[model samples]
Target: MSAAPHTPAPKNLGRTALICAGVAMGMTGLSFAAVPLYDMFCKATGFGGTPMTGTAGAGKVLDRTMAVRFDANVAPGLGWTFTPESPDISLRVGETKTVFYKITNKSSRASTGIASYNIAPEKGAAYFVKIQCFCFTEHTLQPGESLEAPVVFYIDPEIAGNRELDGMKAITLSYTYFASKAGQPLAQGGTAPAKGDAATSNL
Candidate 1:
């Protein structure tokens, strides 16, 4: 006949199948890891207008001061009152400081919220590094309960060197709280929050 039609070895077919299976498994794993990887990438590079993250600065606070305006809001469904304790602050670039926002649950039922944050003049996001932020976590409030959420951060000194940001003396850091079902439980055995002095600033 024609050399038995030059049949391929079964072992070769099995090896090819195994290689395809391995590649599929690897792709699945990558898919599972994609979200966390993207989050880390954003926090590191401030890509897509995401803010950068860092620990305490290098202790090289610049002499030049910059205005940091604070703004807070509650998404419609949250049923929470939110406001920045301070309207604005002035600090030297690279100076680390804390700012607090007050959040109060207006609903008669327990509620949970997660805060989303952004810095205006989006170009400054890359240089507004947050060392610690309440936005990184969730908050739960009892009916009529309030809390002072704090954020510790510093403007990267390199921001002062960016020509594009020249004359950008003020940067607004804004936060909005959204209703959530998944958050820490509301604390029990505490007094209900009232409308008075919603936020207190310890900074």
Candidate 2:
């Protein structure tokens, strides 16, 4: 005998479709929320070598010291020269120090750029605090203009106690400059070009 008329297709196909639609909407919402969620996570956990943001604290200095190196880069076609005035520095944790990054508008036309940065040995990111930095700010320079932007920072003495970061002798701070898209024309939903390829450094 023929198998009982082949089992009929799902009687609740419409319900299945509705469930799928719900899932799709859920994923869409998550995609939109992902950026801010990621930013919050980085600020909280220091994941992916992301650093913490805060102002100066106790200003207490430790006997133990670590080496810190500065790195810089410019996006392609940005027509700018970017470099750290200081190649490297050694300082005690909790000691606030300032460093400069020089940027020159090499193009005849004025240019604008913004910076983004991260630290290496990702685990140490949580402890690399920047009391002041030029990152996230638009740096607009007149044709042939050159300026030195400052970054005043300190290492959290708490880092000396982080088991995950223990045994770390140094940390590298890297930065990249992206062409400013603040006012550039764009397609619908376009976002500012505030990101660039990372140039690693050694501390």
Candidate 3:
């Protein structure tokens, strides 16, 4: 006679189900954590266009000058106009400079926006530093209201020694305003509507 087919014990099946459920939960948590963790890594190493944050200016300045161009943008549903006050400026490698960006709400209703920023020529970003910036913060504006935000930054003097950047004469600093709600950027990832008034929030 043929042997009877073996079946998994009830307890074993339950344990297998629990293990699979745990794996699914772990994956979901990782998905939520990926964004913030990537952001932190970029800020720490300037791996992407994200620049390094500093508490103060570079202690020393270099004589070699470089041109820095400013760029600004507003997302489609944000109902805002954003632009850099100055198109471009020159700075010594280690010199600290402050610049302003102008933001105006063109919508009939009040809206909130948060600024995201980055630098161009990825290789050069590692050498760019910011002493102060208005990025990653929420700002709410009434209809037809306007505001001027400032950015303080410098090019690390160490760039002078980086052979790779020897031929780089200019760098671009760009910012994009995205509709925000409850401290989250709606344009990137959020369920909130574009129209809402939010108090100031930080990253």
What's the distance in Å from true for residue 4, model 1? 11
lDDT of 2 at 87: 82
In model 2, the Cα lDDT at residue 187 comes to 19
Give the Cα-based TM-score of candidate 3 against the true structure.
0.83
Off by over 4 Å in 2: 1-23, 183-197
* RMSD to true structure for each model, in Å: 8.4, 4.7, 6.1
Looking at candidate 2, the ten consecutive residues that score lowest on lDDT are 185-194
C-alpha TM-score for every candidate? 0.79, 0.78, 0.83
Residue 148 CA displacement from its true place in model 1, Å: 0.5
**Best model number under lDDT:** 3
lDDT of 1 by residue, 70-137 (tens): 87766665688988878999999989989888889999999778776666666777888998889737
What's the CA RMSD of model 2 in angstroms?
4.7
Off by over 4 Å in 3: 2-18, 188-203
Compared with the true structure, what per-residue lDDT tens digits does model 3 show for residues 56-126?
Answer: 98999888999998878777788999988898999888889999889999999999998777778767778
> What is the C-alpha local distance difference test score of candidate 3?
0.82
> 145, model 1: CA deviation in Å?
0.5
State the C-alpha lDDT per candidate: 0.74, 0.79, 0.82
Off by over 4 Å in 1: 1-11, 183-203
